[model samples]
Target: MARLGPLLGALVKIRWRTLLGRGSAEITGEVLMLLAAGLMAERFLQYLPEFPVVWVWVGLAVCWLGMSRGPEGVPGQFPLTRGDRMVVRTVELAVNPLSWILVFVTGRISGWGLCLILLAGVEWPTWRRGKRVSARPSRWPALLRKDLRAAVRLFDTALAGVIVLMFVAYAVREANLAVEAAWIVPVVVALSNSTIALNAFGTDNGTGFDRYLLLPLTGREILWSKTVSLVVLVGGQLGLVALAASWRLGWEMGLVVGVEGLSLLFLLAGWGAWVSVWVPFALKAYRFADGGSVWAGLVAFALCLGPGMAAARGDWWVRLLVLWVAGAGCWVMLGVAGRRLERGRERIRERLP
Candidate 1:
């Protein structure tokens, strides 16, 4: 136990440094976001009186588990010779029983049992195959396809999509909530999309970082490809939100929100590209760093959402003006980020570890 104490402490410190870097503001913002999410979850539960709270808890747990990027190469850097497989399995075994307890306590054993069965059915084949698979050379189509697949596979990405839908549904059910939906929907979508953009290179998990350099594509091409992929991926989700919002808030309001959502996405993607080059960090499954791009996103969201909501109040010219300005700004930022990415490729490579 004495020896394990220091080992655990070392592990925590390493994770903190890797994910959060030295940003106090980032850390604080993440904590506040977490508290806000908890409050929102409580309110969400209140809205669903018929549903079991346990299901929400279970869903949250699953989403949290899915958010994990899994054990990356950092664990390999440690003196521990056992490898990450053992470490990961040990942690899983320790926490999995808690899931079972939640299921049993809720008296939804059968439902939870089926969920476990379905999960096993989906995961078993992948686990059985246990082989290292390499990606094909980076072409735009292939890269986009890969990013889309990765996005779908991630629990948080899917959760974000669901949350957007939930917000839309809530707006549809509660007319009074429409005002909140305008800015809320766009902010949520922007932050969701920014996850990949800001942590662009981190997705390589240290293994593929070097292979990117070897690829035939230029840095600008690589950056643009990722940007386009994320825009499409998150844009599709935003479209659904728009449809739902439109159903409740009317076409004009929906159109305005939709335009604002897309604009926020573009702004975030551009900002993400710049940060990816200038302040890259390794991706982790769970950490405060997950909210790394959020502070900037919130600032942009405020700037865009205020004028957007006002314009939505009934000013066609204002809406058009805001869209044009935001769109132009997005393009300028993208151009600047691409140039920075090209110039800083060497530094980015050096930082990846």
Candidate 2:
């Protein structure tokens, strides 16, 4: 206690105004935690016969529909105008029907449910903020790193909770068969890991991510660091899932699952990290002047869904080899393109006029 006296005294000497702000922040945090707990507890109740999973899904659907019908005048356009309204609506649009359907049919929501929540909270906030923050000519690496770190911190608690819940569910219910469970690790990793890099690269203003060309760092290096950070985080999570699933199955299956998970994680992270560069270009075809809109995102999403589903369902080895080749090609092409574009006069129009 004596050793803590100075520290306590120093803390007390801090501004009261800062303390008040922090106190409010703490209260907000507690409220959010309580809300999440209540939601999850409601979900847990679905285990009882009186509370069918189907009914739970119906309730979720209702909540989503309620939220989607926002303030009377709010435009339901590509990019929502209001943050709170957008948050409420987008979460409903993204999660409700599909996730509810999945949970109702399968009795459990896949990692995709977690991904949806993340998209609503983190990716949506970035888009909403980016709309207001004009493109200042800045280095891409610094911006990318800042965004990545901010996003990780933003979604950390929500993600950790969802993963823990998944772990508990898998452990207690033995819901997944040993073989299918082994597959789940790789499938979930492959399915979910790419969005981080993808969203990071895509979530900028009308200037697009191309302004990175003006930076001192080579595009390859910028891409490399982003890919590395994304891969490490996703790979680490995949590894943990493998470790857990391994305890259920034998070591052999465990090792195989782990390798599969890593392969998928790296493959998608690399591909997504690279293709993220083309987002601005691809998006140009859909909507050039309306920058950072969720409607544009929805279209890009639809374009990706077929390919993503194909890749996810294909033979693991074949898909892995194909993705490896595609990723290598993208890496080389993106470098060449970055250098050419960086040095040359490529007049890319702003997405927002």
Candidate 3:
């Protein structure tokens, strides 16, 4: 344990430098956005007479997504022992608390804060270890399977799902709640799923794309593989939320949530594929903006909210139509994204360090 300190520091330093190298402008923009968000949140808490429990759910979702996903740095090319991996993760876990400092500053520290802190502590040792992928045709399944495994291994994802289920159970039991408020369930699911879908191809920072380009596979095939994996991952989260809502709120509300959730997920994954190729960003150790992640979040919010609004109106036919259109649109977008990825391989290569 004594020998692990230097190793962890060195790994964290490398990851930090890689993140800052993206660009000064990009980092500045993200920081500004974050500050603005924090200020807005502080104001919301101050002035809003009745802060909905929905935001609590959203906060938990964000915490889970952020904590469960492992560090995005490229895995060391040399072999690492289990101890080396554990030390590397310890460094990553040490950084998690810095985010909560914002909450403390905003004077919002409460049971929720304590709960999230405790949860992060409990899950810290479970960070997914990075894997080395080979650039071979037969390795595609292995690659996809690895991603699927990571998705499930995310302790935050599972915990967030359970919390959502409990919330649904409570919401369904309340007779005074407006039907329009049911939209929150799907919206939350959409936001939660987007954390993974939006960075589909950029999951391993910018390192994997180089190997991907080397593989004897068409961009379309690669894109499809990623899409399938994302659907499986994000779809699982959305499905759980839908099932819980259905069980508690009756099949009618559940049907709406299901359609809305699926539509939003498809839109996010399809659009994310295009972004992954066209505006590809690196999911660096400290930064989230590799490939227009901020813009993607904004776009996802807009898209998700649209379905939520439609759901609140209680128009089942309209909701179904929206779902059909979004599904078809994603299909077309995926094809275009594949072609773009192929054409832009040189550009993507240049973006990587």
Q: Global lDDT of each model?
A: 0.61, 0.45, 0.62
Reference-based TM-score of each model = 0.70, 0.44, 0.63
Q: Write the per-residue lDDT of candidate 3 for residues 187-302, one digit (tens) a residue.
A: 76556556556655545545677777788888888888887887776677677767766776689877887888788877877877777777665444323333455777788788
Model 3 misplaced stretches (Cα beyond 4 Å): 1-141, 148-166, 169-178, 285-297
Cα lDDT of candidate 2 equals 0.45
Per-residue C-alpha lDDT of model 2 across residues 257-320, encoded as one tens digit per residue: 5656555544555445444544432221101111233443454344334334434466556545
Q: Measured by TM-score, how close is model 2 to the native structure?
A: 0.44
lDDT of 3 at 316: 80
Candidate maximizing lDDT: 3
Clash number for every model? 2, 1, 4
Give candidate 3's error at residue 232 in angstroms.
1.8
Residue 325 of candidate 1: its Cα lDDT? 70
Instruction: Kindly report which residue stretches of model 1 are placed more than 4 angstroms away from their true locations once superposed.
Output: 1-34, 49-58, 67-91, 96-138, 149-159, 171-177, 286-314
